[model samples]
Target: MEWKTTSALSNQAIRTVGRIVEGSHDITIFSNTRAHPLSAQVAGIDIGRRTLTLRVFCPAGNIGDYLSDGLVSFDLEKINRDDPPLLLCFEKVQATCERIHSSLFEVRCTLADTLLITIKPGGVRVPFVLGMSASVSLDVYTGLTISARLCNLSVGGCMLEVPLEDSMPLTIHQQLPNIYIQFPNGEGLRSKGSIRNMRPFGRARHVAVGIRFIDLDRDMRQRLLYFITESEAELARRMGMENRRAGISPLFLVSPHDKKPANSNKRRNKLPPMAHAIKEVARQQHIILHCLKNERPFPEDMLYDSADTLLHLAESDRHQFLYALRYLSEEAAWVRHSVRVAALLGDVLPTQPGLVDDAREAVAGILLHAMGKPLLLSEHLPSLDTHLTASQRNLLKHHVEALRRQLHKVGWSPGPVLNRIVGDINERLDGSGYPAGKRAEALSELVRTASIIKIVDTLTHARNGRPALSPLDAYRWVYGNDGYDKKCLTRYVRRYGLYPVGSLVKYTGGFLAWVMELDREGSPRQVRVVKNLAFQDSKLDTVLADQDIQQIGKLEEVVDPANFQL
Candidate 1:
């Protein structure tokens, strides 16, 4: 084959190559003949080295034969059909190939020449905001399953937002043998396709993969068309409403100088330190929980990273950790509960001299242990006041196995110690717990500690319709229970006191205060009064000694923070 050569690429061609590399779009590489062209995707482009790295697909296992001569030819075509044909081309360019897996090869070649080409665009894609989820399985040989969200849909193809960690092994044009999409309304669509493009999305936390459906039957195409039409109409309706609300018109425009600066400090001032920390932690946990619920692989890296953050917060200020729990939102209830349990464990476990290593595993395990509960039950678990049927109870019990199977599917071994902690958290000493009903003798120390913390948090928090127990009452409930380890309970009480650091309490004089500091014996040493006798907003910091408590009034009662909108 003969090709035209150029000393340099035009600015337009340079921009096109950059887009191709960033988008990981497919390109064609020819070895000796155009008929034997190898399809490849741009992995990277090195402007300094003038080299292009391509991940070439070789289903026939003949890439070595094609690249034996260490030379190849390829072309970069125009991104849009309206543009001039052929952006760049190369002939007999020096190249090398290395096998990545069974049918994938990474090929690097130097850029040499230029040509021009044209391309056509695809059908209109309807983006979704309804939180549709997808399960994608690669070819049977790879046995890799990817959990993704539908970004947009069309008759011929769709775009998927895959978790960035899960997209690491995927290459452009890689065959996805199976894709199952589940809509919020219980509708499901199945198809087979190959990836056409991949690019970073949403702060580089996820990758958007463009997939072209192959051989859709009439019924599937009709359904897809119907969905797209409905989605488009809905989108148009929303846009129209927003425009009307803003009184949008070509005749009316706002001057930049007339606009007021945003009050960025307003929110910061309104939210308390505990509330701010809860919001930050909630944002991180949302991603982790989303992955788990979608049956995606356990994000161990993200889990540990979040664990470190939670542990640091717990260690640096036990008050902040406990106080943050009071601000948990009803959204992502599982995540909220798990995080609370983890934070509590982070504070309590470190004080033990011998259990330092176990503390890390225990905190991480607590964060993810109830992962299957959200999938099995509602996002907000039924309150203790709600009576569950035997079937429902059984279903809840099965979450342990559900979580274990999810981990197994991704071939994730959370190590024996962490595994044991996650697996045995719900087990009881009296053989009352489900999923093997292991007795106290079989449970490890870490598991025992985890069980105690889980119960304490569960009881201390208000759920769907149940009232939250005061910290003292919650501790008393656990102390009365036979399933928990007494030694762990003793240590827990000693560390947190009858009224924990974050406990809201009413004094004899009708003053409402939050416990801020506790002495070695677990007595409150300092308190922040937030309400006066009239129940009005007030702030008064006071240091308390044993004599002060007797002189004023003892803490009349431990109150629920939620009751005061704390």
Candidate 2:
């Protein structure tokens, strides 16, 4: 087929195509006859070579015969439906093919003869020179939080303007733990980013740091696009009004606007009730950790507030809290673990007489108990399976002292109740624990309860190189141990069943599911089947009732939740 072609592609066109290819958009490959069109997806792109690698969905044997003439045609379509319609058609493009698997073929094609038309604008950076405040942490361990102003923003990344003093310690390509931007509505957006470039700003009074956002979720991307579209419309309207008032003919009569998707009005993606709670608690814990690492005094009231929130969540719906722990992001294991322990403590502590008054303080202490570990260990943080040298073990023990010093530096005291819980939570009944190494009587009831909760969480969750023990195994380990108080351990076991909520277990017939609820006897009552008997992920989350379990067979064993990304 004869086709129009461009000698060179513009930067905008290149960016648009890059996004489409990276997004893995489906494209149709056609030969001379449109009757036998082969469906394909863009797998990879080589910008320098101007070539595209496609995973074509066709019989491997048929692909060789289909591309025998070494020519194919396809179209690169726009990624967003909201964007103006745009299509870049490649006509009779030179091609080659190879078998990837049974029904998949790998096709490589060079865009030698291409027709580029109706190119949608991409990577349009809108200036946000207004007072858009942002906090960027250069390193998670160092806790170096730098204040910056939003200079310009786009869907991919943004440029921040920081004072020269604040930019002194930054390096190019340094991964930032988080970039928190406070929007006009007082909501904050947290993202992981890396420094791409740095240069002096106007007058050299400030530095312009370019950051590329990494792994932005769909919700974040939509928010950014909405902001950019609104800003562009505002700019156009302002310019048009200015020109009309000055009695000068407008350069362009019509203003540009985005045709947003129907659901674009929705601010954020709807997460499950439990997932939303877990996310909020995790976000708060992250901020608290950041403060502790930086040696800054966070709002003291926030501790009690968050503790109360956890307590309420645990009391009202302990099962949901337990199940939601699996949804936490994998960035900060310590923080996630702390939240789990604290929530568990909240659920278990209320049963003890006279302990309800101290439950809030106990939960707060559990949350911040390990806040100092990241400051000291940094990259050397040890896991349960890590074989630590004597010196490393001793260093790890000093994290308690480190936390005390940190609290003292901030001119805050957690009070006597919180102090005991934080300081002696690691101490065991048999004097085997570290720091103080208090014996049975020396460790208070509160300390004993929190300690059991912490150990149970540590053993049940996978970390570093260690495979997680089953809930029953973790409980057994603690119950069989000497340091734990039997009463507290029994309470814990009663609260969380042998196969607790969030436990990934394999039943008879090779079916894998997550324990969702338990009966009075702590036996699994409800489960959500994630994987079928063939070990393939189930398209639908099929929740099985107690009766359904009998037909599926007995509960075989608890598998590591990490393996299934539960």
Top candidate when judged by TM-score against the true structure: 2
Candidate 1 overall Cα lDDT vs. reference? 0.63
Cα shift from native, residue 501, model 2 (Å): 1.8
Q: Could you list the CA RMSD of all candidates, in the order they appear?
A: 13.4, 21.9
For residues 225-253, could you state the per-residue lDDT of candidate 2 as single tens digits? 77665544433333332221343112213
How close is every model to the real structure, measured as TM-score? 0.55, 0.56
Model 2 TM-score?
A: 0.56
lDDT of 2 at 414: 82
| Candidate 2 accuracy as lDDT | 0.65
Judged by lDDT, which candidate is best? Answer: 2
Give a tens-digit lDDT track for model 1, residues 1-566.
32222233223233346654553233666443112346677777776666778898887778865565788766444333222122234446679888999999999876533322111242345544312222344431243456776766677787777655455345566676777776544466788888776543422234557788887899988877666655544433333322223432221233456434333334434667766765555555555544554445456766786678778888777765676565554335566678778888888778777777777778878877856665453313332224556666666778888777767775677877778878888889988876788998999877887788888878987765678898778888888888889889887777777788777888888777777777787767777666665645655566455556554467787887668765
